[model samples]
Target chain A: MTEKTAITPATHTVPPAKFSHGVRKGDILQVAGQVGFLPAVEGQAPTVAGPTLREQTLQTLANVASVLQEGGASWDDVMMIRVYLTDTDHFAEMNEIYNAYFEEQGLKEAPAARTTVYVGLPKGLLVEIDALAVLG
Target chain B: MTEKTAITPATHTVPPAKFSHGVRKGDILQVAGQVGFLPAVEGQAPTVAGPTLREQTLQTLANVASVLQEGGASWDDVMMIRVYLTDTDHFAEMNEIYNAYFEEQGLKEAPAARTTVYVGLPKGLLVEIDALAVLG
Candidate 1:
């Protein structure tokens, strides 16, 4: 059996609870849901990137990518992604941002399958995104 | 590079969108979000198991397991599970049902990491779940 390892980027603070920010076992990496919080600052409460969905969505995607990097993967390795939005109306805008971001990244592999749904998150958090990546 | 294949079980109807029920590439399989719809009957709409949380929760889990089976993986191979609950109050009860169900399955490997949050599912649905499994 392949050993399981927990992954936390060097720049990230310890997750609030027991869970790792990402886990890698075998060739698979699962990134925990990441929100729009800006880069961590010790002794400072995590802050949302901004008030708009565009700002938060971009930060959320960047955060997801960072965890993937910590696992020795990248957006190109992702097979699936799930997005949780607090407001149903934000779906279109989220997709707009998501598409533009991925297009710019130009993933070399087939784009990941994705699912989006409405969900409530803690205050100031507009989006939470997670990913599953398979490294060859 | 391993080829990516979309998986749709024989018992399932074509997904309403351009997505697969599950997708497998190399050693990894990603199952899309699944709700508590009962087994399918050709020419009929998908139906929920019942109106209660337990009924729906169990069915939702069975739905996830079926997809894993389709992809040649099982709950024992799962690396992560994300659950979206329609009601905040359902968290505790859902966990109770979830623990009992997994206990009965008796997964032989490390239990998959899990995250749960409140969401607004379609009418009459109380939960949605998706899984990521890695096969040796």
Candidate 2:
């Protein structure tokens, strides 16, 4: 049996609950849902990256990248991604930002399978993203 | 490199978009978000199990199990599950049904790691669930 290891990088924000930021069992790494909020300073609450959907999406992806790197994986290792948006109307705008991020990372040819759905988020949050990556 | 194969079970409803019911690479199987709707009758729209949250949650679990089985997995192989409910008020009701199902399946000792969040469903759907399973 493959044992599960929780990944908790110092750079990533501490999770509010008992869950870890990500968990890895063998080559597969499953990241927990991530919002645009940055890591809090100990006793402080987490803060959002910005007010707009585009800004939050970018920060959320950055946060995901941080977790991926800490787990010894990269964008190319990601097999699937699930994006949850607070408003369906923001879909197009969110996609534009998401697409560009991958393009900038030079992973245009091997993009991960993706699924997007509209969901309700806590106040002041616009987007949440989670990923599953398979390493070599 | 691992090759990805899509699983499309005849007993499950056809997805509305251009995605497969599940994708398998190596021993890992990733199933797309599944709602409580039953398999369609040819050209007919999919029907929900019932109007209540408990009924819909049970059907949704059934649907997830069908996809897992089609991909050569069972409830015990499931590693994690992410549940999206339209109403946060329904969390307790949903969990009762979810826990009972796993218990009845004799998987009470090691239930799949779970994360539940509130989200918006298209219509007539109370819950949506996605899962990851690993085969031996």
Candidate 3:
């Protein structure tokens, strides 16, 4: 049996609850849903980056990447991704930012399978994302 | 390299878009988020099992189980699950139903690691769930 290990990067603030930033079992790592909130500094309330969906989407992906790296993986190792948006109207813009991120990472030809759905996010958050990666 | 294969069971209605119901990469099967809407009949608009959160949660789990089974898995094979609810007020009720389902399936000792978040589902939908299963 593969034991599950929690992965939390020192660079990231501790999550508010009991959940880890990511959990690794065998060769797989399942990351918790991440919003665009900036890393917590000791005594301040967490807040998302910019007010626009594009800005939040960027920060969210960056956060996901941080978690992936902490788990000893990379974007290339990600096999699937799920994007949650508060408004369907922002889907196209979110994808534009999303696609550019992968393209810049040199993974445009083999980007991971993705699913996007409109869902209400926490207050002030326009986007949230989580991912599954397979380590080679 | 492991190849990715899409799984779509005949018993389920085709999704509105291009994505598959589930995607298998090696031994890991990642199922797309499934809403509580009942399986489509020949000539009917899709509807959730009932208007209540409990009813919708049950049907959503069933739908997830069907997709998992079609991909050569069962609830026992599930390693992680994420639940999305439209209302945070329904958390306790959702967990009661969720826990009971696992108990009934004889998975009380080692239920899949789970994360629940508040998110709005499509209109008229109360819950949506997705899972990742590992096959031996």
Candidate 4:
């Protein structure tokens, strides 16, 4: 059996529950759903990036990227992403930001497949995103 | 380019939008979030298995497994599962059903890493489940 590893980036606090922020086994890496919360600050409660969907969306992507990088992967290795939005109205806005972000990253592989769903979130958060990456 | 294949089992309806039911690129297969709807029948709208969470949860797992099987992977190949439950009170109930189901499957690999979150689902549907599987 291949060894399994839990990944926690320096930017993240210990997850609130028993799960890792990300886990990699063999050639595949799975990032837990990540929200727009800013990187942990000493002695401060977790906070969202801002009130706007765009702000939270970018920060959530950054947070998911941090976990992927910590697991020795990158956006280019990502094969899929799942976005959770609290409100249905934010769908188009998220895609616009999502498209621009990946285009800027200039991924070498095909754009990762994605699924988005409307879901409830903790108070004040608008989006949550997670990723799956494969590496050679 | 490594080939990317979209997976749609005969049991499922064509997804409403551009998204595929599941997507496989190389060794990885991603099953899109699935709710408790029973397999579609001609001329009938999609419907949940039952009103009870246990009934819905079981059907939801079956639905996810159908896509995994379509991609030539099984529960044993699954590396991670993210479960979205509509009601917070149903977490323990869902876990009980989840544990019994997997235990009955008698998987060979370590139990897949799982993360659960509270989320909204379509009316009368209590859960949504998705899986990531890695094949040799």
lDDT of each: 0.83, 0.81, 0.80, 0.82
lDDT of 4 by residue, B50-110 (tens): 9998998899899889989988999988998989887789988888999999889887768
What are the candidates' C-alpha RMSDs? Answer: 5.6, 5.7, 5.8, 5.9
CA lDDT of A121 in candidate 4?
Answer: 83
Candidate 4: stretches off by over 4 Å: A1-78, A88-130, A133-136
lDDT of 1 by residue, A1-136 (tens): 7999999877665688999989999788999999888888989877788999999999988989999998999877788888888887787677788878877887553566666778668988888998878887
Q: What docking grade applies to model 4?
A: incorrect
Better of 1 and 4 by DockQ: 1
lDDT of 2 by residue, B1-136 (tens): 7756677778778664434677777887888888888776888878888999888888889888888888899988898898988888998888789878888877746778888877676667778898888888
List candidate 1 stretches off by more than 4 Å. Answer: A1-3, B6-21, B34-118, B122-136
Compose the digit string of candidate 1's lDDT tens values, residues B8-100.
Answer: 777665554444688889878888888888888989988889999999999989988888898898998899898988788889899899999
- Each prediction's DockQ against the real complex: 0.25, 0.14, 0.14, 0.17
Residue A47 C-alpha lDDT in model 3: 74
lDDT of 1 at A124: 80
Q: Across residues B1-136, which tens digit of lDDT does each residue of candidate 3 receive?
A: 6756677777676664434688777887888888887888877767778998888889889988888988889988899898877788999999899888888877646778898877655678878888888889
Colliding pairs, model 4: none
Model 2 docking category: incorrect
| TM-scores of all predicted structures | 0.63, 0.63, 0.63, 0.63
